[model samples]
Target: MNRAFHRILIANRGEIAVRLIRAARELGLETIAVHADVDRAALHVLEADRAVSIGPAPAAESYLSIPAVLEAARASGAEAIHPGYGFLSENADFAQGVIDAGLVWIGPPPEAMRLLGDKLGAKALATKLGIPTVPGDDSERDRVDRSAEPKDQEKADAALIRKAKGVGFPLLLKAVAGGGGKGMRRVDRESELPEAIRSARREGHAAFGDSRLLVERFVSPAHHVEIQLFADAHGHVVHLGERECSIQRRHQKIVEESPSPTIDPAVREMMADAAVTLARAAGYRSAGTCEFLLDEQGRFYFLEVNTRLQVEHPVTEMVTGMDLARMQMVEATGKDLSRGQSVVEWRGHAIECRLYAEDPERGFLPSSGPVLMFKAPEGPGVRVDSGIMAGWHVGIHYDPILAKIIVHDHTRERAVARMQRALAETVVLGLTTNLGFLQVVVRHPEFVAGRTPIDFLDRHLRDWKAHESPPGAEVLALAAMAEWERLGMIGSGSGPSVVANGGSGADGDGSSPWRQLGPFRLGERRR
Candidate 1:
């Protein structure tokens, strides 16, 4: 006779926050949003029934602060707190804090988060369940039982070095605490182990403040595929489907599509089995994503388990027609998941392209500023989940993600066509985004043919340079020089330049003269 939750507090911001709000609203539940000072006018803050200020713009001051989030939940009179995707979403301590505060935590159990949050621990547990994890010489333990001390993050340097000797050289050093490619290092030789270890510890210290790292063999040419699953307190669990997230940068996904084009039905069943087995072994509940590395031979290796809603959950939602957030809320309320997952069955194919505020021409540098013009494509099968508005200012402190453009269709081919059309119609005026590059990728022969490897972007790039400077600075510089010569801005002896036709306007204020996109005043069109 218990309901999971009636009112949920969204303990994060940006697109994911807004995403949870919509999903929860559709289920007829109220939502509360907590924000930092910078996001006072954020879309999520404005959309929620109620809002609370957590802290300043920095994540440490707001989103990641356990007390701040819990306090916001209490003040807003929320019955549960939903940690959407990032920030404190996967923090076991934060989850514990919420439960300790006498509120439901709308995610997998904290025990599950802690156990699988560590790559080494998850791999060991997967192996115990006969689930295939990437092969590594855990020479330290002949059979790595989850009970065995993870040489991946040993208590002593000498022990780690000794274990490394058995695992062989060129092993990966990754943080046992967090994901998103932070605190990771590759040591090719014995001489490199010390530096690699030190480097990893330093990074781990900075990112998670827990310098512990896990050592594993690195795998390449592996496609990243993850299966999203839902579990309720009664122990019923089901897989929504698989997502192809191989297109990435710095180990973070940029594009994700459900019903991976590369996976066969048999392969999907196998992967889903492995994922569910691992989750069941760990007593996992609520929404979570189990990542796998599908090698060239179509063999899958357990990668990690994300213990919260994913940024790409909507892709699954699009295909399955399931409200993942609502499912999570229901599970937290103690409902049988079989009922919910049964009600909403997965259908068609869905693709999601993350529209980041970055430039592809200039090594994908983070682009920021106010969005003078923002238009999301609409149609029968297309959807846009975004946090930015026409007048919203993009800041430098947070992630550069502007929006997520998704397309759903009965077939992958049709979804691709719809997605391509959606991309063409989408526009932003203030800063350079991945708009141009995404169009190119969607049309690229390798992508169109669906023959890309895991390192597709690495091979795609010609010059390997950092993207900290202004986006497309090099391209803009060259174009400006050409304009200077043609318009006679430099001297009379010049050719026709871009500036010749019109003068340049400031881009940060959303008044750029170089761009041609304007607002969509015509009522609205479905993408």
Candidate 2:
């Protein structure tokens, strides 16, 4: 142990919390996991050394509650707290609370988070540092007063429109505190500005409790790439390559891979240098991501800084052979980095597909029910990070992501093939999943040729639907076999299973009637 902390509290749930608990155990440290009522029996809770109930099912009253988390930490005797990615991970006040409670906050300093967490401030800082930022109006030009009267609101809207016009049409109205595409909208024409502004602001307030917004020129036919950054208090920082997150829906990334296929070596170095420059300027430490938009012209612009670990971090880890969660734990002890940029290495290719409990045919609407069956694929070069299990409830109170399947290989082609194989082998019953849709995406000819763009889904799958084609013979046979097994109609042995004399048995010849017949049907009786 580094001695900074012996026991840590994870103030989040799902796969991330389970990830942290495993990392902490590897370092000879104890962990306390907090959960809402709906998550009392969650996989993360079962994995942690200790668990605490924070509040009700609602995130606002539970996972987002600062006091409850701190209280749990104090009660559990945890010397530190790790906010795993979402929830209060990026909340500056929560960081301050952890520090004020006399515990180590396993993340960047609250001050740094406050500065870089705001899109407008980070843009200004990037500009001062000569970093390329998207052309747009900062939040100061379009700040909305939530409590303002109708006239004042109208005045603010008018001013925002004027400033937006200056930036030109085909722009984005984004929340100053936005992340994960929340509180953001695309305005293709001048007429949509007012309604878009109102919706964006309302979403901003509802999602992040911050209605401040900024405008930016929307660059289409672009690829979304982000660089992973890690720093220490001793002023040592390193960039862990880049991730190609262009595969998205509604501006939210669904598929990510490391060693972006489209980035030039020179451009990659430049983007890494820019990310480190901004991190050093902000005095940032811990794990964070610097997002950028790579346009068709090969020019990249700084999008914003995520002040916490990203959902797609596993892709980086698979290529670099590094455990970022463990790094976070060690760095929280005020230690210098274990290695500098020179020692850092990248190998092979890594791809990650986020498995969500949603119906892709129905526009990815969240699906919730008991997970009657859950099976994860495993083998060489395959890794699954999940926080769900059979017989567990999937609620609508949180993100619908059930798990992440990450695959690594010596080449991008192999990686893609491995991911496709893994997805096909994996199974989750009782709720609709995007597994079929993901299969279609990873197998698309353009994706296979590495011609992915930000609008890949829109361009190829605009009217996609599930079950458009019939299952193959193998699939039908497997379903029948599973049903037979479930019904105990087949004996559990290596020999051929048969129904002899109206009793289940194994055939000596290993040639059963069911095996001889391509497809067999069970006799039905009168209802």
Candidate 3:
């Protein structure tokens, strides 16, 4: 049954929420932005046709509260709900709640989300479908038996160790409900298994409220690549090529590019076919991503599936010329795909760099403060999707990502050069950012040669530091003039007098008074 909706409610915040609003407007649909009290004046809220407050600043009481989100949708008279990504996006119960409330859910069906959202379940499905998966124990009985008595605890631990040994060392302990690198740990040997299991369980319980864990053999010197899939209720599914997301830190991707440099036409076809097969078997619809690990032998293993929109989706869109958000909405209405697999075309290479408000020098600690100045690079193939402005205050309550910079060009070399230029022109003056670090990564020789592995950062730039270039002579002169104006010496006769001995005023130290002004960059504070 097809249900048409005139208005849609975005059930997330930040850059993705803003992105949905634009997509909705383009389709002649009214948008309602929901926010926590702290985000009353956020860019998304200001951009939507209507805004509603769900709760306080805490996500639990606001965005994650299904009842509160549903109430906001009802109160705003929204006919459909779009969980952009994260938060309640992959929650199957939330999707059912939306459908139960007589409103459209612009995502996969609840059943499909449940089948593919769980790491264990997805792995089992892949094996059943003859898809290659990393060697590991996907057995639910192997999970830590928390409810067992003290005497049984030792038995449970021993059983888990036996399973780990069978799976082999250098394995990853992952949470069944984990995403974005949360609730995961790596154990290289048998001696570390018990403690690693306990640690992974605690982290998983805290992050996803599920302490269940799964073990998989870790693949080394591998490239993290994912296929973008789109399906409709009419049995149509197509892949939008692959994105190489091997350059990462802490298991979270920071750089992504489409048409992986390592994937030949044959490997690309195999991966695409496997992804489409999984989506079809699971009865998935709407926009989703199927992640994989590609090894040096040209073999690929299926990772978990992200049953929602991805942050790096823009790169796929840039290469395929498709509007994923719009496609999701169209599929939600029971429309068949406008095009088939053979007709889908991919062109020019594209790359995206995620900019975060974190200090790379200080171990990538998150930094929060008011954005003093924000200038995004602009050119023929540059694109920036951002959530904050000059006056916006970044808080510690949410993800530190400020924006994503994407660029496209005819060739990979040209695309790399364009990305470097765009990164250089990007400016965020108020807080410490990874702008310089991103520039360094794109310019590395190995990266240019398309040889990025999972440990690219640790293997290459482990001891990376920010290089501070001294201000130029013109900048010093301007700073001196500004300092003199501030001291009221410009118009007064007591102004600093220049001497032939490289001294100014009464000081013979060869330094100006402005030298006392501690670290500051010359730039106008944008409002």
Residue 462 Cα positional deviation in candidate 1, in Å, after optimal superposition: 4.4
Which sections of candidate 3 miss by over 4 Å?
Answer: 141-158, 469-527
Q: Write the per-residue lDDT of candidate 3 for residues 1-527, one digit (tens) a residue.
A: 88889999999999999999999999999999999999998888988999999999988899989999999998989999999888899899999999999999999999999999999999999999999999998664345543313236566557768888999989998988889887788899999998987777777766666667788999998999999999989888889899999998878899999989988788889999999999999999999999999999999999999999999999999999999999898889887776789888999999999999887767778888866446577789999998877557888878788999999999999999999889876766456677778988999999999888999999999899755554554665675566456545677764432211122222233354333432333322312
Cα lDDT for residue 166, candidate 2: 96
Per-candidate clashes come to 9, 0, 0
TM-scores for all candidates: the values are 0.82, 0.89, 0.88
Q: Where is model 1 poorest over a 10-residue stretch in terms of lDDT?
A: 517-526
Decreasing lDDT order of the candidates: 2, 3, 1
Winner on lDDT between 2 and 3 is: 2
Candidate 3: 10-residue stretch with minimal lDDT? 497-506
Writing each residue's lDDT as its tens digit, candidate 2 over 83-170 gives 9987899999999999898999999999999999999989999999999999999845335454312347777778889999999989
lDDT of 1 by residue, 1-527 (tens): 36457788999888888888998898888989998999998889888999999999888888878888888888888998888887888899989999899998888889999898867678889888888887564332332322212345544556667777777765777777667777877777898887777777777666675666666777777789999988878877777789999998766788888778787789899999888788888999988999998887888888889888888888998887777887787778786655543464678889899999986657677877767546577779988888887558888877788899999999878888888889877866556687767776677767777766677887775443323333344444464444354435656643222221232322333433233322211111223
* Superior candidate under lDDT, 1 versus 2: 2
Q: Order the candidate numbers by TM-score, best to worst.
A: 2, 3, 1
Using lDDT, give the best candidate's number. Answer: 2
The TM-score that candidate 2 achieves is 0.89
Error of 2 at 102 (Å): 0.2
